[model samples]
Target: MKGNPSLAVFGDWDADGIISSSVIINAQRHGMIYPIRGQAIIEYEPAEPVYLSIRLDEIGCFDAIAILDVPVIDRLLESMRSYRARCPSSRIIYIDHHISTHEKIEDLYGVVEEPLVGYVPTSRIAFDRVVSLGYRPGDRLKLFVDAVDLMDRGAMVPENMKGLLKIVSSISKALSYKRDPALWRSAVDWISSPVPLSSPIAGASMEEIARLAAESEKRIRDEANILAISAQKLGVFRYIDARRRWMDRGASALASMLYRKLRAPVILCVASRDRRHVLMIIKYPGKAYRVVKMLMETGIAVSIGGHSSLGIARIPVERIYDALEMLRSSAIY
Candidate 1:
């Protein structure tokens, strides 16, 4: 293209997002990857994927961009269209594992797309993509990817999965607080090398994660017992108010704890953080592909997306009870 082309890389704040962006960045840095229509190699910067939706006006400056691990495809269409109009030849690549409807993908044209939209983690997809392009990351990186996938998918076997999850949890808990983009980059770089999982590169991250995990676990242990006695049950689902003495830990960890303690096929945790808004996290078994569609059909949720096992949504505070009732009766799950 013109001078050194700018390529903005947007990824979510999860381990999958961090690794996905890292793979592309490492490949580009080693001259193993290049832009589609540029003579000079591309220079990229990492950004939170939500920025593209909230700050659409700033997208035109980049000659090429890659989005990783972030789903909300409908929110991105307008910005992608704007950028495409501004720079007709610019490249747009989107890679995600969130299940998206076919209609959403059809709205965009001329964008390079690789959406697994399955149970697979985005990091695995990134790994395969990089390998297809002839870049081979070390085995440690593969182990790191498998750890994240197993943890996310709630795999509890093979013995080593538990230890691997502890390491991933330490990194996740540390990242959840500050979420400095540099920390994610450092994690990618560290795992890309020969460092073992127990290396001191993590510093006190494991201790911090343990503290947070313990607090959350204790809360769940206490409250889940109360919920089992009090919560209304519909079929195999249990509806629990998640606000009671709940710590501000990560949602995945909380969901996992709730599943183990409650022993329910589905656990819907509803919390009204403020009088103006209500937040909910639904942890369910099987593929919940129709849950979002059914929830939005009720005109209750503002937004919702995640894996089939876990989902997060926002609603009006006044409608919390109504939303719960709707969810109970909908039978979408």
Candidate 2:
């Protein structure tokens, strides 16, 4: 596997995904400690299901593929299995922290699955796994990984980590569920650099994004406040905001703010940017498994995925009420 091995690394566009891919590629290039040796590393960061499907077609070209921090694995198992059967020498590695997909990952054949629990992000998982394989990262690298974990898990305030958390959050906001290779490369370089994180590195567009995120937060706060007082609770507190541009961006933050304040299972459906679709975000604290299982059983949500206490699903605009009824009947929320 050491001689000019072709490699493909796939991850989400979020902090965990980008950092995890960077760790693997950096290890592969140095070859001083990590067991992985690859001649060329190809990276794919898919922003949506359509893009992900397209990238899946390219998997057969690589000798090894690492899927990190990608939660929607049930849709890829068949393609992966076919690829493995076609290229018996190829290897696939999966690392994730989404608890709802544990069984699915366990079922995939001819791949290495490293599923973690609690607030651990795939970057930390990749770091530990690489170290176990004899890759010794420096103190700065470890600290950066730890900062990412804390930021992703919402475990720290803005004051902690010497302003690294703000930097990561600002960068992620600028990315906005989209893949920008150049911006991503800059972020990777910063994380892998030996210098300690001291100042914020906002991309050209990041200042604007920061302002927009602040505005969105205010709208979400007001909406969530209304829901906290008036949402209908049928197994879960359900609220739908069909206001125009309600989901222009940052739906997850809204859902999180609601959950943090309500301290109860919350289901939020926000109109999509096009107003022709709805995106659902559910947070159930210790009951994420039940909520995810219920949604799957309904067979309505497309590309559903969940971490330990939060889940997200996409639904057709017309089916929003039907989905709510299904959730109400499931009694699992």
Model 1, position 61: C-alpha lDDT score? 58
Off by over 4 Å in 2: 1-3, 31-35, 38-50, 111-119, 152-162, 177-179, 195-236, 243-249, 260-264, 271-277, 316-319, 329-333
Local distance difference test, each candidate: 0.62, 0.65
lDDT of 1 by residue, 23-50 (tens): 6665555534633433445444344434
Error of 1 at 278 (Å): 2.3
* Residue 309 displacement (Å), model 2: 1.8
What are the root-mean-square deviations of the candidates from the true structure over C-alphas? 4.1, 4.1
Best by TM-score: 2
lDDT of 2 by residue, 196-262 (tens): 5543343645466466446645666887787667656766565545344357356776777877887
